[model samples]
Target chain A: MKIKLVFVSLVSFVAIAFLIYQWWPSPERAIKNRLGGLAKTLSVPANDGDLGRVTRVAELRHYFAQDVRVRAGASGPEITSRDALLGLIGAWTPPPGGWTIEFVDVQVTLGQQATSARVYLTAKVSGHDARTSEPTLDAREANFSMAKQDGDWVVTSVEAAETLQRPGSQD
Target chain B: MKRLLFGSNARLSLLRAAVLVVTAVVVFGYVLLPVRLQGISMLPTYRDGMLNFANRAALWWREPARGDVVAIRMAGPRVLYVKRIVGLPRERVEIAMGVVIVDSVPLIEPTVVYKAPWNLPAFTLGDDEYLVIGDNRVMAMENHDFGRATRDRIVGKMLF
Candidate 1:
């Protein structure tokens, strides 16, 4: 009877330890949390003040590395440095109704060293057209390369993965 | 009444409940993956905001044939695109004035109600690639999403 009780206690302890290990914060989870914060920061509110807009744009620079590469779309211009990206973001004006950005179906694959990760996700932007006030939703798949920098994940590169190929384009 | 609700014995009742839970998990999580339609890409055949299931076991026996509507997974299974297979593997596909040409032959599509003057040069699909497109050809080619998808990216065929 005593042996059976000890075995049961051992099994319970092991199960609890396993559960805790599974629930502990991991690198993948950290990257996902950072991406979520980025999406939240990218969303623009219609009633935002000029100061808030400037502050948010400045905050966006922290999400990327100093030499981040950004390719907006298949044929869009590429920004080679974080400063260039910040310049574009600061100059862009939101629509009349503002817009909300979300990242869905995020799948993060850690590199062999675990210091870097590759994330594939769908970037969804929902807003209203300035001309017609009609609601518009644009979703596209994007790939992000990130690395651990100063104890936080920072995006190093971004590339849009187009689902459809354009005419006369060989890819 | 209690015996009828559960089983004759406690052990049997526990076993029955466990079996039921396992079956539910297997059937729903693996066999029939629930999908919610979002866009107007499949306007005529499947409207927006429709709930459907993609049978993951549909292609277990044979490869996907032409006209089979499938769910193409992007990045992950959480969001997928519903499109019909038009060009088979290793076949040349083109869209000239919105008419799909497969291997220089114009393929007949009874589902497309409206046709636009969409043009795309002929391109051959790879061995493991399948070309998919929506039934709503009325939309501009530039606006629509249609192209070659690898075999592994296809999640499953739609089960109505």
Candidate 2:
């Protein structure tokens, strides 16, 4: 009877473990760690030296997920693969003074091996001048979707809009 | 005194079962759900927020069609994007100003709002690339978008 009890317990344990893997990714902690590391790499101070950071971020684009679509303020959308992200960084007008992720939220569905994240951005773009009310501050909120494929995770889509707390803050 | 309603043996077994069930649901849902979202970007036709199914295993069996919406991966670890197939391998496509011309002939695609000029540049798709475009142009990418999309990036076609 003792042997039977142990066998039953072992079988039940294995089954439960499998269920957790299907339901939620405890392994995704690795992905979280990588994300924090990547953020540090992409981050650059927005100062007179901001140009270098912008350039580095542009170069980093090549390493970014290829299936990026930038919906340019309701004008046209760009389906950026590696070349567009890496080579055409100069053409892109990312929010001025360079932007950074102020906050990030993630929700994971284990069965699909997918994660949905909402990242809030704080961008400081160039406006008129200090004499003219110190130029406007720009901020954007973007929603991103990432999925696992063949043992890797890549960004799939992003929807971004400027979020403002006051009058005319959103640009 | 509180009754010993649950024996240690029975309670332990029950707790184990609950954890197992939760894990399974998470794994299965994650893979299936987002993979579906990737290929279902055919808006208006497929809508934006609905969930679609992706049989990531399709590329091994057959090739994509002219209008098949597909999810593709980028060079990075796991980036995926979706778009509709516009041209085939080695076909000439031009979107000048806002007009689309293929080999000196206008495509007159039903979905496009503005056509691109055909004289932008001529680059035939390599065996690995699959030329694509969104339902609405004018927002085309920087590259002479008439280029190739690597075969490996092709995730899967969309399903309602």
Compared with the true structure, all predictions reach lDDT values of 0.86, 0.50
- Score candidate 2 by TM-score against the native: 0.43
lDDT of 1 by residue, B1-160 (tens): 8888776775577668878998999987888889888677887999876899988899888888899999988777767889999999999889888899999999999988878899887888888888999998887788888888888888899998
i-RMSD of all predictions: 2.4, 15.8
Candidate 1 regions with alpha-carbon error over 4 angstroms: A1-22, A46-49, A96-99, A126-137, B1-20
User: What is candidate 1's DockQ?
Assistant: 0.51
In model 1, what is the error at residue B146, expressed in angstroms?
A: 0.8
Predictions' DockQ, in order: 0.51, 0.02
Q: Pick the candidate with the highest TM-score.
A: 1
Tell me the deviation in Å of residue B78 in model 2: 4.5
RMSD of 2: 14.9
